[model samples]
Target: DALYVGNALSYRAMAYMDLARMFEFKRTGVAYLDEEAANRGIYGLTVPIVTENTTERESRDNPRAPFYKMYRFIMDDLNLAEACLSDAHAVSAKTDASIGVVYGLKARLWLDMGSRFERYVDDLNTMISHEADEDLNDYDKIGITTANECFARAAEYARKAINEGYSPLSESQWFDPSIGFNTPNNSWLWANIISTNDIAATTGEWQSFVSFQCVEANWGIAVYQDEINYAHGWMIDARLFDKIDEGDWRKTTWIDPEDAGASNAFITKYSRGTNLSYNEWRNYRSYVGIKYHPANGERNTSTIGNAVSIPLMRIEEMFLIEAEATAHTSGVGAGKQLLESFMNTYRMSAGESYTCKAADMEAFTDELFKQKRVEFWGEGIVYWDYRRLELPIERGYPGSNHARQYRFNSYPEHVAPWTNFYIPDRERDLNKGVILNPDPSQAIPLWEGGN
Candidate 1:
């Protein structure tokens, strides 16, 4: 019970830190006093913490307070969990696994928060060190400063999880059509598995819910597919993909055909057969439908296949993060040396010769983004990268109106008109003090007329 509650609380805290990092601007550049003022003011003025049993009066008076409180509570709980895990042996089946997960979550949260606040750097460094020490056995035998170190850490945890008998189902297990589609597999680290009946009967198809198509079909969803796409695309800068020699496995796996309109082809890392509809039908819903029909199976029953485990954290990201962080602190050359080692391993895995020299800082950074994008295509970390880097959203790649439209016309701009529009009630309530809403005419145009 203690472990469960502790893990849950820690995960929640990590999520709150993630949100604060993404939504709020960094407090690092501000004056020390100003930073303190902002932190204290936000902490005080913000909503009080509340749980499921929060009173209605408390909620009504300070709606946002509970969220803030919950974040604080999460941090406290995570600290407690770390302490508890330290003394206890790994006698329980799930204790060690939960501890590792909590450590990873804390590391991610701290890393993100570090970008926003100066104090968070020390916190993040501490967390990373703790995780590194705890999960040392999982790491590949490599020097700490090398690019391989990051990959080694990522791979270590991932391998530990797998070796401990927690792994995602293989492609064959997920695609096999002989078993019932609902059969659960061991690969899912954590998931909310919904019923087939609930899924098929829903108006939105599975593909519509999970893929980039979700944005086009429904604007209501907060996360945009284009944002995700652009974020991932930006990571593949000239340094990484452009430098790869012809016939490299990463080039084939990481990059799609760079063509526009009908000629464009998507990278295959996240690509399943056709769309989700076809894949769903192939994997589940054995009945012959418009989208899919089993080669042989009863109605509504198809051979059970393995589901793709949405990798929350893999070995690859750790490598990139370590390399990037080291590059930022140490010289770019040191970082490149680390990156090259990983690249060599990657090439060796594909039976190819690895050859590349890390020379310029700009080139190294570019390569970092490229490798990250190719490695973590669909797992949803791209937006975080852009936010951390403070890069402006570039529309339509290097040159194009379509790209500009997509980039500049963000969620804030779209919602601003509605938020800051003139209010008739305000005008009526305070005649002499009527709020002067900015005119639409004065607003900067995000893009010129048409493509």
Candidate 2:
């Protein structure tokens, strides 16, 4: 129970830290914006001026907590959790806290925090080196020092989890074809494994929320089928797709064979069997499975078998974070060297030659973005990456861009100036009419207008 709670808290912290790094302006001592520059829009809009009390009421509070505060809170919680779990002894004869789960979690949290706060690079390096030495486990510790060291670390941790008897579902273990929906592999770290009967028994609420079918059924909520297509396609950035080459295994694992006749050719990472009922198969809920259980009336029931062990902190992400931070701190050349080394490890593991050169930082940064996107797709890291890099959110289908634009617009009103959102009316009333209405020109307009 303690370990689970610790892991959960650590995951939350890791997420917040990532956001903090992405949104907060680096404290460069001098403010970059001057009155003239500000008029020219050269310095970019001032970060939205927000105080602790008013921050919560700003337009950007959808996920809850302002960006800066969220990071601080996450860091505090993660630090506390790490401290609590640091000395925890492992109970399994083969696995203990020192050698097993705790170390991986710690290494992950440290690297995540360290990555965002460049000052913590050394601390992260120390943690990685320490964990690699202590745990000879693969998934938890993959490549010691290689070109793809970061990716290797991630792979290593995943490999360790698997090798340590973390079972992924096998073909035979999948549900019967006639029953619809294949049984999830036992190897899942955590998953929302939904049975067909579970869907039929419910009032389609479970199927609607969790399945892609929600797009069609929940059109009133602004959800639609094209939304899924947009999400899948939007995730396919050029940099990441290019890295896969023609026949990489990772690509094969997620990308489906093209169906020329279908409106959308590409499939998704999660595959529902053909035999599954349309209502169950077509919906995201069916694909991801329901988050709640009918029996206990509790959400995220571990017993109902839908609890997917989503890898919150893995060695690969740390490796990338370390590489990026190291490169930023060190010269770009030095960072490229680290990145190349890590990539080579990935190549070797896949029986391919590590072909990247460490000569160009720009190219290397591009590669880093690519690898991170592909490796962490569907794990909820892309949104943060887009924010940190200040990359525009573009989706091919309709409503996708609107959703992202809404998020971006909310940022300025709720947190910082770079964020965009209309000033709240309540604030106008409370602050003696000091609230400034958001400028329409400042909104990071969506990529598409309509579906």
Candidate 3:
């Protein structure tokens, strides 16, 4: 019962954190507008907060909370979880909310809260800062005031997770047929396990089975066997692919652009019995990822192939957060040292040395972001980080391979306002006080800068 409650609280806190990131002011994507909104208290809304103490009637009338209140609510849940979580479970039990998971979550939360410290810090406007509860008063000690304090807390919590003895997966384990991403390992702090009996597996309709491109499952036959000309397989942007160094093992995660013919193993293996023409069986798609394959190296045509666990939190993420937080809290040199240490320990090959050439904090963070994108591709993590960093989506460059409809640049100055979700009509209907976000769903034109 104790473990269950702790796990529930941890998951709840994660959900709230997602809400805070997703629904914060759209204006914050731009620097000048962000400062203006922070000063005027305009567009600082996030999703509504609900707790066990709240009645259903109260929920029906609840308005979206201010961003600061939502941040506080998430922190409260994490604090409760930290107090309640058990250290009995080993890190290998990746589905459980172990102490490492709590610490990692704290690190992630503090890193995010630190990014926009001006808005997250409580002031006299709403005045929810001084609750009579002693636990609420403990916020200062937990590092919730200045940006430096928040980063320090992030680094501290991340180190706590690292000290739990969890290490990154080795290269041999990266695409191991026996262990292939489907099973939980010691490297993960938390994961969502999909059992053979689960509907996702039983139906063989999960995105990982059909959309991962390299898996020989479901609609995947269209790509591997050339049974049909389904051109909608997941692929990486050409610009991003070009940026990856050839020496980096991660660059091989995708199909090499030079190996477009029947020489590719996927086409040769599956096209043996098919009546595919010479050109039909060839893999024409560029930069499609092959990192995630069916379990046991078996074709995912069967139900068993669909049984895979998705990692929610990994030990490597804690390392990244720690390094980034340290860079901001201390200096670029300290942060760069940690980055190099991490690479040498986990990512580098024998006799290979890694160095950080970033001279300033911005350059250091840019390098860190690139490393993270390559490391965690197809894991649904880069999106949050990109949003947090206010990076422009530049897919409209020359020689780009992105789909025609999506090939547009979305700079912060122009505003990709649809990045923030609108409140659903059903939700607004249920909660009368809820205000819907402005719709920004129009098609964006390709940016023509420097053309």
Candidate 4:
């Protein structure tokens, strides 16, 4: 198979996993608190798996597959991908589905499957490899499973990344000033460039979505002295600004709404300052997402247009994955150390460092997810993190200032959502076995008596 086969398999597997997450209930096997609660999770696995080539009519008429059957299909494709992709290929303008990415995908999939499966730990080990080429002079390999070993391996992988001359464009890589999320650095393993050629407004990528969510309507910096057609419609939640910890360099990237005398806090990642030439200043939309910054350099991509790379997998995520898996398997202490090291190195400002030992497993996991949300905000993958755990869809505590659409209403104000998008009607019609999932509550968004 061509290297691309691995990439396609990876993408297909991801699609199924995401659908499974939306349609199936949390799989930690804790036993849903109640039958109603279980129903809210779509306790029945109704989505189908078609292994053979079939038409929409045939596919629609096919029966829904069991949960394991679907995952087994995904794993099958991934295992094949692992065998096909190279041990590691240096990243380029177009990142290949390298063996490392294969491993990273496996780690994520296994984590979604939860504690019953331990194979993902070994998968991570293999992907990082022989201590992830740790010895600057030595190519010997080692396997790790326990927390301590995992921690050491994770650390070494990060270390090897540096030793191999993989430096952040600067110390501010997290809220990267130069690339923000646009630049692919040594830290990036797989990144997909979205040229204006790739831009789709009706069904757009991160750039379009951010333009809708982060930018104010008609907020394009047209007053500036350059030509680029861009606009904004939404803004970042002020509460999210309140969440950034002091001394964390990322906190400085946004203009606080209060200080700015505005109702919403806005991120600098996309805001082109007022009265600045769009060509010289490079800020296009005050409410636009900078993840795929506008690049006029590409042919036909004029000043502040979308011609930037979208990061899919980065070394930063690998560090967190190892830390999380280590905590789950080895113990909180090992995992905690790895996480603290990452924050100290990648997240903190000059002369500022933060460290913690989890009082318990839950505490440690909490910290890991928190770091994930902040670090990966606007990347559009954090929703899966919450869904995998079957956690509530909470924006803020009761009576908080979060916008209404951002906040869900339930008894106690935090339970299942009243609304969830179902499989599109077209899919249901084309795929005969497909059925619609119901809201957790018929009358309200939360379960009966749920708060």
Per-residue lDDT tens digits of candidate 2, residues 1-451? 7666665665554444553444333221112322333443322221233333455555343222333233334445645665666554333322113223433443343344333333334433443454434322321332133233443343344334334343322232222222112122222232233443554324444343223321222222213344454222122333344456553334432233232122232233223322223343333221121111122222223233222123333345545655665565466676666666666554233456555454565566666777777666555655555444434333334333223444332221122334323345665455442323333344343343454
Highest TM-score scorer: 3
How displaced is residue 137 in candidate 3, in Å? 7.7
For each candidate, what TM-score against the reference? 0.52, 0.47, 0.85, 0.70
Best by lDDT: 3
Encode model 4's per-residue lDDT on 177-239: one tens digit a residue.
335565566766667765555544223333343233322222233212225543322334455
What TM-score does prediction 3 earn?
A: 0.85
- Candidate 2 lDDT: 0.39
Name the regions of candidate 3 deviating beyond 4 angstroms.
28-42, 89-92, 118-143, 204-214, 218-222, 262-284, 413-415, 447-451
Score residue 377 of candidate 2 by CA lDDT: 57
Model 2: ten consecutive residues of lowest lDDT: 285-294
Candidates' lDDT values, in order?
A: 0.39, 0.39, 0.70, 0.52
Residue-level lDDT of model 3, residues 15-109, one tens digit each, is 88888777665652445545654664547688888878879899899888876666667777788788887563464467778888889998988
* lDDT, residue 304, candidate 4: 34
What are the per-residue Cα lDDT tens digits for candidate 1 across 249-273?
4443322324211122322322232
- lDDT value, residue 17 of candidate 3: 86
